[model samples]
Target: MKPDFNAMTRKELRAYILEHRDDTEAISVIVEKIKADPNIHWYKPEDTDRFPEIFAEHQKCREDARRNQENQ
Candidate 1:
């Protein structure tokens, strides 16, 4: 039986995708989730005024990741 991708957490889905690279459905779900995440920001070249905001967001994401890893 196929696993229910919707029921899986992002971390679980990531692990599943790595182990089953051929599962395009799982990949699609993860891609959609990422696209819908509010914390994610896509920077554009024309948004010059927003560079600082974008950079700060990126830095915050990196720091949060580091903290999560350290806690783990």
Candidate 2:
């Protein structure tokens, strides 16, 4: 289940994602939620302008991390 992004603060959102980071489906859901809410995660003056680009970069980083992971 996705967190109520509309009702959650940025800190709460981060904690929610961090706790469920291992859950791929859950992570995707929350990420989409943040993407849909343009106002969310909007911290710092620059983030408002750089959010889309930064989010794309971060997504790529996560995908690269996943691809490089080895079963332990």
- Steric collisions counted per model: 0, 0
**What is the lDDT for 61 in model 2?**
73
TM-score of each: 0.67, 0.35
Error of 1 at 67 (Å): 9.9
lDDT of 1 by residue, 1-72 (tens): 979998988899999999999999999999988888887777777988888887887999989989999999
- Residue ranges of candidate 1 with Cα displaced over 4 Å: 45-53, 60-72
lDDT of each: 0.90, 0.68
List runs of model 2 lying over 4 Å from the truth.
Answer: 1-43, 70-72
Name the candidate that leads on lDDT: 1
Question: Candidate 2, clashing residue pairs?
Answer: none
- Model 1 is weakest, by summed lDDT over 10 consecutive residues, at 36-45
Q: Residue 33 of model 1: what lDDT?
A: 87
Q: What is the RMSD of candidate 1?
A: 3.8
